[model samples]
Target: MIRDSYDVIVVGGGPGGAVSAWFAARGGASVLLLEKDRDIGIPVRCAEAIGQGGLQGILEPDPHFIAHEINSLRFIAPDGTRIDIQQTDEVGYMLNRRIFDQELGRKAASAGAQIITHAYVSGLIKNSDSIRGVKVRFPAAEKEIRAKIVIGADGVESRVGRWAGLRTFYAPKDLESCYQVVLGGITVDKNLISLYFGNEVAPGGYAWVFPKGDDIANVGIGVSAAMIDGINAKKHLDQFIERHFPKASILACVSGGVPSAKPFKKIHGSGIMLVGDAAAHASPLTGGGISNAIAAGRLAGEIAAKCIADGSWNEKDLSVYTRMWDKRWGDNQRRLYRLKETVFKLSDDVFNKAAAVLVSIPTEERSIKKIIATTLKNNPKILLELARTFF
Candidate 1:
């Protein structure tokens, strides 16, 4: 009971938490942001490739946070056939996530939010059925801070929403177990991002190579957790690398999970709201989250501040956050998720046929969905089967 209260309390000082704190402070609310980690963004867990279109006007990325600019994509099928898609100037970036997270937290602080690291939130502080604040603990201390609104921007393992009784569980098929390795001594096109797709390559998901420079890159795979049956992801990744770039030197390795399901319908309840990965806002097709994280965070922060200003923290008031998120990104994600379902069900012949069609297309007309749909058109039965199963 330190007795320090704020207008809004944001848990987890990642991109979402920091952005929400920034917007909440900008909205004139006193805000507190807490991070369990000693630093705002350490222990990198992402593939770190963001689309240029995804990161348009929210905030211009600082130079310190951008590792490289990508201008094209190279899609490699299971048999090693490749389809190169030219990137629009408005698309693709390789980010330095640690610096990115720190800058976002700093921005939030500049907007008047108080930030504390190594301050793990242990539970929610509730007044009857409404979340009043959070109970937090640090290395040598513990306290409870009351607030008008509590935001759960904590990642996939979020406890804030769980404590507040929001359902955040993901079925095994809906979560991707990801492993990435930054490697040097590998020659990759500095202007091209690479993706590998095949059930054997990455069951239920895909593999990627995002070039950091001409000779270094981030190589990784996202596979369904449900598909991990005695085949360790790290082993598969190592084998792939050894087969493709045997002479490359490994720089670093990281592992984490990405949620690919539609966000929980009840991300906001009572006086609490969930955003970012906690709300499962990562895009389904790419498992790319930075853009959606910032989007959802800003929305939640704005809605929370408004609710506080109006002195109403009821579910109905908080529903604005849900509506805003749906209007902004929910439909796109749902459609992508459905598409992913069809993709994961595709067989080797189906994938090869799709690749053949992509190879047949003029370079200027090659696109992701187009290649797959065109190949399926040659076999209407297969297209109908996919559509029936998906739609």
Candidate 2:
């Protein structure tokens, strides 16, 4: 048994974990970061698409890690008619997530945090209602590492938060099954992101074409949990690509699920905290998490530092992270989740009708939200209910 101790232990080495470890170490706490994967980032599971605007509050992602920069977005309706919308603000980027995650981990290590790869945390060591440390299994053996604070930076299947008796299970309706194919030898504009939406295509979510430099693109689709049948996401993705970009050859394929729910009510407990996907920090509107993960991770680490600095570690003291995140981002997620629920319930016929109505609008007024409102305008009762729900 290789027992060790630290002021703070962060489980998972994704962006969230890395950021938490970084900030905790910066705050002068001895931090230990653990990852189940042999490396910081591998077996890419994300579409690697995010808006540059989403990253404003965190450390700027270095240019070497961004695969592509996009200035416009194209929307395709159910009938295959497309609408090209130029963005007034910087809109999108396709990232090299493998490099990105590694850089994040490196930043934490540079800040004096120790990292251990290939370590899977099995369970939390608890003293009645309080957490004390974690039990980990590594390639060589097993060990128990004690810590004053444990941060759950693990992804969606996180057992750390659940083991601590936190609400970590996502509702079926709150998840979107997604698939992505990184294609090379494809000629695309390289500066445009394409989004396709309709019940016939993506169910509750949407399909995206994120260009990654010249001759390459990351194409993907997200379908609601309710839409996943015997038909898997990859099969649907293949069909979509075959019909849309018949000549493109795939270089890599990725599959995962995005949690489209609001953040959990209880992410912080005595001596324990949950960050990133473990706490459902992904935005409900876009099904994006990278930026939010970094933001939440930093906040959690800073809060942990304060708790330790004050020599007080309790659920109430740790509530600073929960309170700060809720005040900044949580309400928006809840509103968007409610909006997603309403839209997902609409049938293809209704969506087609909505599309037709949207195309008729002037180009100057054809906004995504405006189109949705106009489509539902005829449903005065539902429109009123929706307004109340979102507003």
Candidate 3:
């Protein structure tokens, strides 16, 4: 590991940190990105579905990292009714995160960011309440690497954000305890993703079958921490799989927590900035973060670089990140959180009714907007919120 001071230091080698390091280094800042794990994206924690629009500026959709291109989705209701939404314009990707995250790290490295895996960052180096750098432990040695700006992209259980006195706590209602398995020899529509709903399937969350290929898929479940009792996410997932794909082979398994709360009020403080799950940047309703993480990473990195060049790296100097992010996505996130609060609590009967209504619509005219329109006929109280959110 390179032991020295730097202009920017990013904790975590996930997409957020890698993208941040890429931009910061490309901007001519000496950047160091550290990952505690042996690899960048091992033990994948997500459903690995990302919208195509999110990749426009950052990277192209290369086959190397894209497992499957998704153009349609099926929403399976409690009564086994399926509402299929086929989109010609809205394309998504089922990513092989192992390669995708490594590609992000390579981009950071190629842009002149120094990266070292198995480098565990224990805490921050602080002076008079101003962030200075990080204290990291390598496989063989412990060292303190100082930097002008330190970004915390260390994920849901973020000690760096805590160390920096940032708001990183999520109430039980906001956290999703998730479990997933890569199943092989499973038959699925190669071009379509499926979402299964109902209390028996996922309680307060949902179950998904994201096809990686015609015969392979990522099957997962996310259960709301508040709504679940003694039943864990894995047990919920196993039961779902037994009912759905009983003959499938489980090739891999992973479980992790996804924070779906609002972003931290203070994403940046003094010389510190938190991105990715550290800031709770994932979608509250869907728990999707790749797009937002990339967006946040790029913004934070560019801002950090500009601020560093201007010789101003305080909390106020970085407040521009907050404003820009809020302008772009804050209101949408708030609206989604409200929708999730209402939707996830809905009983199986409501989901069944909604699914029946949605299925009745012509498949060619079906979309999320149609779902909202249907909801208006059922629940007039949330019409305003739904309209403001989707339309």
Candidate 4:
């Protein structure tokens, strides 16, 4: 029998929802996590890369979900100049999202959170000015589930946020339409992730090749919709693959949109809150969201539990979530967004020059910090912006 009421109802079962449900249940709140898909993390859409030590405080590392460990990065310029940088102190990982998501959902279940997959949330349950719960549709029936608070961990095209009257829409320039393919039978550096930049390659975005193992990698391209110029993301990605890995065999294909804008000013209102992509918490520069989503989900869950315990469900009470997120990541995201805007405006000539400058740097000083410093030496304005963003 499904309970009609819960302390918190979390919509969507990605990293954000799973983490939110786990933390909320762990905090003693009666939680319900709903996933529209029959299986969590199906049809992996991400590039599957995360920074080293990103999930240390959030989720414990599970070998079952780690596909590859990366220790270096290579940036390829428009003119085919490759600049390699090794992570001497920090590393990253390529995750099997299908396994990682299911494991996260399992963790949430273990924490006393009830999960229901294939249950699509069709509408919100409202009481006066505050959100009360959600209307879910099952294969055989449609039902209502009530909650003290509702958390939307839905993706870029989130309806939950819009239903709650939040500005979840992103401008074309602030959205990245991405296309990716898993390629096998190709030779690639198993320990290094590569990024390719140029208008012809990705127009306002970048292309990436993240290794999964020996001879296998997830190759993808993200193109800003505003800069697509009549072409689609797949077209750009196809051109890149043909030019570089012409012999690689395609294994799987995925496409999706990512929000590349700054976070909304408000992620919470009354008894509702938005986390992850719904909140636009992704990194504008790199289009990375997994780590930030997990972090935001955990914080939202903890705060939701507190609200339940204190019997405070008003917007003002929930505003703490927004404040905390801004303090933790908002500034960094804003800085990165500024950098992205500036970098996207650079011409192919500028990119070629930057790559040339980077190649001139000694191998010992080829760190990202030094590369940026050397490349932007000719552009005092951008260099100043970079300094302010980092320092």
Which runs of model 4 end up more than 4 angstroms from their true locations? 378-391
lDDT tens string, model 1, 1-391?
A: 2348998999999889999999999888889999999998897888887877655656686578888888888988888889998855466789888988888899899998999999999999987789888899999999989988999998988888889988898888899988899999988888798889887888888889988889999899888888888776787798789888899999999988899897578789888989899999998778989888988898888887887788898888998888878887777888888877777777877777767766888888876667667767776756876676456
Q: Whole-model lDDT for model 2 versus the true structure?
A: 0.84
Clash-forming residue pairs, model 4: none
- For model 3, residues 1-391, the per-residue Cα lDDT tens digits are 4857999999999999999999999888889999999999987988899999878898889999998789998989989999899987789998989999999999999999999999999999999978999999989999998999999999998899889887788888899999999999888888999999999889889999998899999899999999888999999998998998999899999999988786567788899888989898999999999999999999999988998889989889988988888888888988788778777877788678667767778999888877778768876545554555554
In lDDT terms, how accurate is model 4? 0.90
In candidate 3, which residue ranges exceed 4 Å CA deviation?
378-391
Clashes of each: 1, 0, 0, 0
101-131: candidate 2 lDDT, tens digit per residue: 8888888999999999999999999998899
lDDT of 4 by residue, 1-391 (tens): 6898999999999999999999999999999999998998996889989886768776677789988789999998989999999888888988999999998899999999999999999999987899999999999999999999999998887899989998888999999999999999898888999999999899999999999998999999999999988889999999989998999999999999988898799999999999999899889999999988999999999999999999888999999999999999999999898888878777888778778777888777788778776767866655765666565
Residue pairs with colliding backbones in model 1 are: 52-92
RMSD of each: 1.8, 2.3, 1.8, 1.6
Error of 4 at 242 (Å): 1.3
Model 3 accuracy (lDDT, Cα): 0.89
Better of 1 and 2 by lDDT: 1
Candidate 4 TM-score to native: 0.97
| TM-scores of the models, in the order given | 0.95, 0.93, 0.96, 0.97
* Deviation from truth (RMSD, Å), model 3: 1.8
